[model samples]
Target: MNEILDEMNGHEFKFIYKTELFNEILAMIEKKKISMENAILLLKCIGYYATLKGIWVSDFERSLLKERFEKMIKNEVKKKEKMNENLLIDL
Candidate 1:
């Protein structure tokens, strides 16, 4: 997963990681292993790894990336909420 992430460019990397993390959370949900709230919170932290790349990204860029990551996370959470609502209705 890290290799795949490394191969992606900056903009692409954020989207890809958000997708992969969302999928992981969905799997955990399917397995009845995690609460929806926790899964969503974990998704929000997926971009912390970017901090470790201090040498690669400038402070300004990192801040911008963090904002973008937050927006991506918010969007993912909204998607999950809608899906959960549908699932509940189906049940």
Candidate 2:
């Protein structure tokens, strides 16, 4: 019983730690301290860890993350295109 309790406690601690790490990553992204590419990499690592831990993520949650990543990539592409257009106009 004690061993089981200890194991549960450890799992709880890991869950909390992972949650905090996720929040920190979001804060860094909001502050522009990390690039979108790096953020995606970090998120992938987080997801991998969660998967290895057998933490079940709902399909909706997965879809939301996917949508967010796609949106960020699209926005970055748009920004680059706009910059290129501006350069062409200037030329």
Candidate 3:
């Protein structure tokens, strides 16, 4: 994930981390290769990078990563919202 910290937008990183990283991450989550807690930790780490280098990192490659993140986070939010609603009903 040092790549994530690098505030560059080269095509090399585009392939290495942009196109491939999220797929590997999502696959690991799906396959239970990573725990949900760990996934959140990873996301928070990325979020930290983003906080520091939002404008610097958000070039072509970062936009591609954004598209994927938008979709994934939307779906995860829906699931969490549903779970929260259920818990409130139980309460």
Candidate 4:
């Protein structure tokens, strides 16, 4: 059916796939093999590319994603700061 074909070719699929890739990147960051900043940068870049390619993410959804990524990066920075402080204390 034409409707089914249209649905399959829609932006929803692209958004879902992007979200999954973002989650995978987060997992890699959690495992300490990559930095949170790096992950966020990659996500943003990819999102921008997708936008240019006609993906339709609303401003609200983009804001939410940005907020979550910023929070995660802040947490990582705080963690590293605490670690350095503890190292100083130990020294």
Expressed as tens digits, the lDDT of each residue in 1-91 for candidate 3 is 7664675454443344454575577678778999645765776666565555543333424444346556656665688845544322321
Predictions: Cα RMSD each: 11.6, 10.4, 7.2, 10.6
Tell me each candidate's TM-score. 0.32, 0.43, 0.47, 0.45
What's the number of clashes in each of the models? Answer: 0, 0, 0, 0
TM-score of predicted model 4?
0.45
What lDDT would each prediction earn against the true structure? 0.50, 0.53, 0.55, 0.54
lDDT of 2 by residue, 1-91 (tens): 3343235443563554444465566667778999656766655554555565676534324343445545655665688845544322321
User: On a 0 to 100 scale, what is the lDDT of residue 21 in model 3?
Assistant: 70
Worst 10 residues of 1 by lDDT: 53-62
**lDDT per residue (tens digit) for residues 1-91 in model 4:** 3344244444653645554565566668778988756665665565555565566644424444446655655665688845544322321
Point out the higher-scoring one by lDDT: 1 or 3. 3
Off by over 4 Å in 3: 1-16, 56-82, 85-91
lDDT of candidate 3? 0.55
